[model samples]
Target: MTSIKIEHVVHEKCRIGESPVWEEKEETLLFVDITGQKVCRWNPKTNQVVSVSVDAPIGSVALRKSGGYVVALGTRFASLNWEDHSTSTIATVDEDKPNNRFNDGKVDPQGRFFAGTMSQEIRPAVVERNQGSLFTLFANHSVVKNFDQVDISNGLDWSLDHKTFFYIDSLSYAVDAFDYDVNTAKISNRRHLYKLEKDEGIPDGMCTDAEGKLWVACYSGGRVIRIDPETGKRIQTVKFPVDNTTSCCFGGKDYSEMYVTTATNGMDEAKLAQQPQAGGIFKITGLGVNGIPPYSFAG
Candidate 1:
């Protein structure tokens, strides 16, 4: 195993920091503080951090090829102005389920935004209810329903070849692979590629490296584990200083650096005191791997 050093890069004290994305063109890292209702940009080169406040809880954001960003604000997909932080509605989702909100999402290789919703009530006992679902928003501002009955739709990425789509529904404790159509943005033939035990922790956000291996952040396990998608076995583990590791993405000049985001949402005062770095962003180097560039929304 290769040892790596993890350092805190941002100390925003976010309530729920998630959706870390690397913008290779600008050499900046973009992520969201869901409960804090803010979108943040961190530029390591200049050591600067900029935040834009949003009206509602923001689940995720994707760079737009057209000039700004496509954001998942609460239950609506909206266009966000990078300079003014103004948002215009593009489409709304899951309006019938008022208690549900968008959780985690990413842009596909073909330029479509994929996101999923989860129940806001946070009831772990009632896993039987299908309160969440997965969706895809295309360049035309059209939305499509992909799957239903999802408890907590989190983490999504596609293989290098764009043939397989990997996803996580946190409550299932498993990573699923689906047959994908890059041209049509359709997914099918779902199968479980990996399943984590109770002690291993539930999978949250994920990204694929150059080798096609998946690096998954464990929500309660306080670590990011690299898994070999082909065999569904663990390859490496990167432990963090906090217990609520939310998401991670590979960035840096050569895409060798891994940036991770953590949360302090459910921790008590005692627990928060123990993990002072919780809700901050972290960077990990010396992993001996590179990540593919993140895709931007075409519209």
Candidate 2:
């Protein structure tokens, strides 16, 4: 186990802060406030924050190789120009299932955009009958259905070798590993690599370090745990002040710093008062590790 220190860096009070990605080229962190329908950028060096509003709920965002960002907005995928806040639709998913919306996603090593959907009506007592699905969008604007009947499709990333694909279906309470073909961007041989106990909380988002350890954000657990994918054991744990810790990514010049996002969507006034930093971005340092550079969307 390693000791870590967590600090609150942003006080935006986002409704649903998620998708923390570090843009090394810009030397800043990018994230989305889903319910607020805004994309934000934070520069740690200057302590400056910039936000851009979108038309609909923005689930996740990925950097584009050319410039700007590719975002999953509500039921459609669009390209966003950060300068003018202008958006152009690229493709739409699950047009028939109005109850479903895009959730967590990332760009693959091959430069393909892979995002998943979830029911908008998620609750503790009510189980949503509307199943979610995952889709892959190519540079040519062609979309492919990868998997279906998914419940709250969440975190996703490839192993250090880019041969094993890891994904999380939050409702399933497990981290699944799949055989990945980088050349074709195809995944198969799916199997459960680790399952979490209910008390550990649900896994929301994840990323891999250069050493092949998987870092998972434990939603209700108020912590981020690093797991040994091959052994299915937790190697390190970094605690946060907020309970709804949503997602995390490594940033900074050396990638030693960790950025985390949390949510305040379902909290009432009392709960919000107890957790004032619920929706703020957190920074963790002294982990003594670095992460691989994030892949960008080629399209």
Candidate 3:
């Protein structure tokens, strides 16, 4: 197995940087600053950086097929107006449960938006166990609860063949898979695909290559791992110096380069002094695996 090195590309130390979606049409990298409550776009071609603040903490973002983006705004899923930074909620969940917020999210091949939720307060815990749920945004603009009891839902990706889903329960340090139904947008046959020991750090955001291998980010491990989901075998481990790698995705013209995002949210001053490049974007080239294009919002 070959290891990859990371080069610091963005300077801002995001509290938490996750969910990266490559917008092919715009040729831009779209991501979210969760604790910063904003959506950011990076244009490498012009060295342009644009960020727009939202009312609530934004979790994840996905490009829409209809020409906009679907945003997870803590408690709701909405459509964003890139021009004015305006948002309109497409669906809301647990309106009565104010202590929950949306976490990780992605669009399936069928164009449905799937997002997960988590309790807001880590201490003085907001909700009882089993409250967090995975939700689906339908064509009629309605939200349906798909599953529950998720703890800090993080990475989410589907296999290239569209037959399997890979997800991470960050707090559990485990990666799981489910038999995915592309047509019905249902997931079943849940099975444990991989698990990270506490020493390896929590599993965060992830993506799948064209070969169907899953590339998962190690939140506190400071590395990204490429694994064979079927056999649960680790094929490669890409290391980063910092200890807060948040998420990664395959981008670039050929989709062979892996773009990674990191965070410095909970780092101590001493640790920050040692790894100053903790919260920055990175790119690793020459990885043999290629990523499939992300699905656009069809609504």
Candidate 4:
């Protein structure tokens, strides 16, 4: 196993930075801070950062094929205007409940947006139930599929060949895979590809490289684990100082760089003191295969 070292690329206060993507068209990295209610864009080539606030809490974001980006807000999905910072809701998940919210999501090769949900309970503690559901929004706006009864919905990605789908149920400590029917937009044949010990921090965000391998961020394990989904073997590990490394994405001209987003929202003072790099963005260069270009919102 190769020792992984984390390099802090940007140090900023992000309440909970989660989803990250490299927009090849724009040559920038875009991410969301759910609790911060904001979206940010960073240009590694120019070394600049630009951000904007959203009306509601945002969970995930992705570039659209049309020219803009799609966002997963508290209970709805919307399109974002990066230049003007304007967002318009396109789909609603739980409008009647108002207690549940969207969590993490990504787009598939077919330009369909796949998003998950989380508990909206106000008990000041994480609850396993009361979580939202998974939804798929087709470009035509006439087709919407709902997969319900979820708890802490997190990472998502598809195999390089687009024949399989991988996902994370953070609290379950398991990474699962399903046989994907692209034309029918259905997932079945569920099986476990990786399982973690309770103490290894929950698995949150994930992405697949061009090599068809899985790269997952360890919520509190303070590192990213590169695993071969088929064999369920750990191929590599990237360590971080903070225990709350949230999500990661591959972006760059050649998609060689892996950009990571971290968090500090649920940490106590002692933990925060132990890791000042908790909310910053980190990058690992010169390694791993590139990732498939993110699918854009079909406008």
Candidate 5:
């Protein structure tokens, strides 16, 4: 196994830090504080952090081709202005399932935004029920449902060839692969890629590396494990000082650095003392791997 170096980069201690997106153009990291209702940017060069407040809880954010950002805010898809810190409605979804809200998501190679909703029960703790659905936002601002009965729609990425779609429904405690069509933004033939052991914790946000392997963040497991998608076995493990590793992404000049996010939502004072770096952003290096550039929302 290779020795990995993990450092706590941002120490703000967000309520629920998730969705770490690397902005290649600006050379900064953009992440969302779900319960804090804010979008933040961290510049590695100067160690400066800039945050924009949103009206509602934000699930995830992706770079927009036209300009600014496309966000999964609450139950609606909206456009965020990078400079003025303003947002405009793009589309609304899941009106019938009022108990649900958008969760983790990512952009496709063809510029479509893929996101999903999880039950509001995600707060405090998740209920033993599946009432969420996955959705895709086309460039025309139209939203389409892909599937439902998801307990917590999280972690999404595409294969190196763009033929396989990798996903995780946290409650399922497993990773799934699907045949994906980039041109039509449709996914089919879902199959289990791998299942996490009981001690590995629930799988949260994940992304693929340049090598086509998956790096998954474990919510209560306190570590990030690298898995070989082809053989469905563990390749490496990166342990964190905190147990609530929410999400992660590759950034830095050469895309060799992995930025991870953690949360402090359910931590009590005693547990918080055990992990003072909880709810902060972390950077990991020395893994000897590069990452794929994140796709932007063409819409």
Candidate 6:
């Protein structure tokens, strides 16, 4: 087994830090503070952190080929000029469900952006269930509904061959797979890849390594588990000091380093004192594994 060490990335911290992405060109890390309404960039080399404020709660962000970012802004999909903090709408949904907002998201191999919505009532548990849906935003400025009846739609990644898509709906407490058609950007053959036991916390955002192993963040379980998706078995577990490990992604010059985000949401003063680093960014290394670069939105 490989050894690992975790370190804290000191910053002002976030109320709920999530959705970490690596910008290869700049050699910097990008992430979002869901409830804090900002997207931040951290440079490990200079130890500099900068951020831009968004009007609404920013769920996630992916780099856009068109010279900006595509973000999940509350009830709409919008283009954000991170440099100037300007935004324009791409598409909107969940008008009927006033309490719904976009959650976790990513760009697929085809350059299409995929993001999901969930009820805003989520705290310790899902207050409203099955009211969320997964949405796709194409470069042509068109929106399509892929699936619905989802609660707290989160964590998404594709396989090495681009033939399989992995997803997680937090309430389900499991990782699921779908047969993917990269050219058409369609997914099918839905099946349960693996389910976490009750002791394991709800699964949140996840990423896959170059070796195709799934690394899942356990929200209340205080650890990230590496699973071999093919065998549907657990391979390793990396514990965290905080219980709210929200999301993770692989980055760094060679994609060998892992960056993780945590949250302070729903934690009381007493709970916060115990895990003082709950809302800070974390870096893990020495895993002896490498990861893939995130796809950018073609639009």
The model with the greatest lDDT is 5
**Model 3 TM-score (2 dp):** 0.94
List the candidate 1 regions with Cα displacement exceeding 4 Å: 123-128
User: Candidate 6: lDDT over CA atoms?
Assistant: 0.90
Query: Candidate 6 — which residues are off by over 4 angstroms?
Result: none
Candidate 4 lDDT for residue 273: 85
- Superposition error at 173 for model 5 (Å): 0.2
lDDT of 3 by residue, 1-299 (tens): 45544567777678788888888788889888887888999887986779999999888999887777899897999999999889998888978778888888998888888888887745311234555788888766878887887877678889888898888777767899999999988889888899786667878889888888989889789889888987998888888888888889988787877889888786789989999987778888867667989887678
TM-score against truth, every candidate: 0.96, 0.96, 0.94, 0.94, 0.98, 0.97
Model 6 Cα lDDT, one tens digit per residue, 1-299: 66798999846468878889999989999999998999998999999988999888888999998777889989899998877789899889988989988999999988999999998865654559999999989989798889999988899999999999999999999999999999988889899998998877999999999999999999998889998999999898999998988899999979999999998889999999898898888999999999999999998
Determine the backbone clash count of candidate 1.
Answer: 0
lDDT of 3 at 277: 88
Lowest summed-lDDT stretch of 10 residues in model 3? 121-130
Clashes of each: 0, 0, 4, 3, 0, 0
Instruction: Give the 10-residue window scoring lowest on summed lDDT in candidate 6.
Output: 118-127
RMSD of 3: 2.1
Error of 3 at 108 (Å): 0.5
Candidate 3 regions with alpha-carbon error over 4 angstroms: 1-5, 121-129
Q: lDDT tens string, model 4, 1-299?
A: 33334588877768788899888777889999888899999887778889999988898998888777899998888989988899998878776666777889999988888998887635322765845677887887543645666778899999877899998877778889989988866888888899976666889999989899999998878888999987998888878777788899988768878889998877788978888888999988766477778888675
- Say which prediction, candidate 3 or candidate 5, comes out ahead on TM-score: 5
lDDT of 1 by residue, 1-299 (tens): 56688999988788889999898778899999997999999989887989999998899998999988899989999999988779999999998888878889899988899999887745321343578899999999999999899988899999999999999998888999999999999999999999986776779999999999999999889899999988999888888888889999999978999999998887889999999999999999889899988999997
lDDT of 3 at 220: 81
lDDT against the true structure, per candidate, is: 0.90, 0.88, 0.83, 0.83, 0.91, 0.90
